[model samples]
Target: GLLRIDHVGIAVADLDEAIDFYERTFGMRCVHRETNDEQQVREAMLAVGPEGGVVQLLAPTGPGSAIAKFLDRSGPGVQQVAYTVRDVTAAAAALRERGLRLLYDEPRRGTGGSLINFVHPKDAGGVLIELVQPAGA
Candidate 1:
């Protein structure tokens, strides 16, 4: 079953500037930041609201990165909506059973140590949807 909204991912040209803007405008503190080499991007996670909602800011590391491509085409904006799930593999299987297209055949390690997979935008009504199984489960 779905747990809650894990985070809303935003693609930006500069992670630092995006972090600063969110901090200054919304008073949101960035709780964590890291560069994921496998994903080829730098990211910062900001806490929002009282119940563990997060805003994930992503900046591509190079022109080859997906975020960079997205920025090139879309000009930096909401990239994906992530939802917490008990088991990403299970959720993915279910989605596949329902004829939904997944971006990858298997889940991969994502930021914050979670296992994650993306639902194809075309199948998800033009919005990328991420299914995340948190670190422990």
Candidate 2:
């Protein structure tokens, strides 16, 4: 079952500039940042407010990167909506059972050492849905 919305992912041309804009405009506090080589992205997580919403900003590491492709196609906007799950494997299995296709055959590493998987956009009304199991869970 889904726990809550983990974060909303936004693809950006530059991570540092996006972080600064979020901080200055929305006052979102950046809580984590990392470069995921496998994912080929430089990402940052920002805390939205006192109630704990989060926004993830992602920038491409190279022209062949997924973020770069997304930027070329969509022009740098919302990329994905992530949901917190207790067990990503189980959630993926369940979604599969319902005939929804996943982007990965198995879970992969996500922000903050979390396990993650995605429901393919084609299977979910063109919205990329990410399932995240927190680091320690």
Candidate 3:
């Protein structure tokens, strides 16, 4: 079964600037930050509303990265919506069975130590959707 909204991914030109804006404007403190080399992104995770909700600010590490391409095409903004799931692989299989397009053939390691997969935006009404299974789950 679906658990909850894990996080909302926001692509930013600068991770530091975005973090500062969130901290000053919304009083949100960044709980974690890391550069994911495999994903080619630097991200900061900010908890929100005390309900296990998180805002993930993402900045591209290089020109060829997905975030960088997105920024070039559409500018900085929401990139994806992630939902917590008990098992990401199972969820992805089910989605595939339902004829949904998945970006990855298998789950990949994502920020915050989660196994993640992406649903194609065309199949998700133009909004990128991510399924995440937390570390150790």
The local distance difference test score of each candidate is: 0.93, 0.95, 0.93
Return the top candidate by TM-score: 2
Q: For this target, which candidate reaches the highest lDDT against the unseen true structure?
A: 2
What is the lDDT ranking, best to worst? 2, 1, 3
Find the 10 residues in a row with the least total lDDT in model 2. Answer: 45-54
Model 2 earns a TM-score of 0.97
- Write the residue-wise lDDT of candidate 2 on 84-120 in tens digits: 9999999999999999998899899999899999999
Model 3 misplacement above 4 A: none
lDDT string, candidate 1, 19-119, tens digits? 99999999898999999888899999998856668899999999999999999999999999999999999999999999999888889999879999999
Q: What global local distance difference test value does model 3 have?
A: 0.93
- Models 1 onward score TM values of 0.96, 0.97, 0.96
RMSD of each: 1.0, 0.8, 1.0
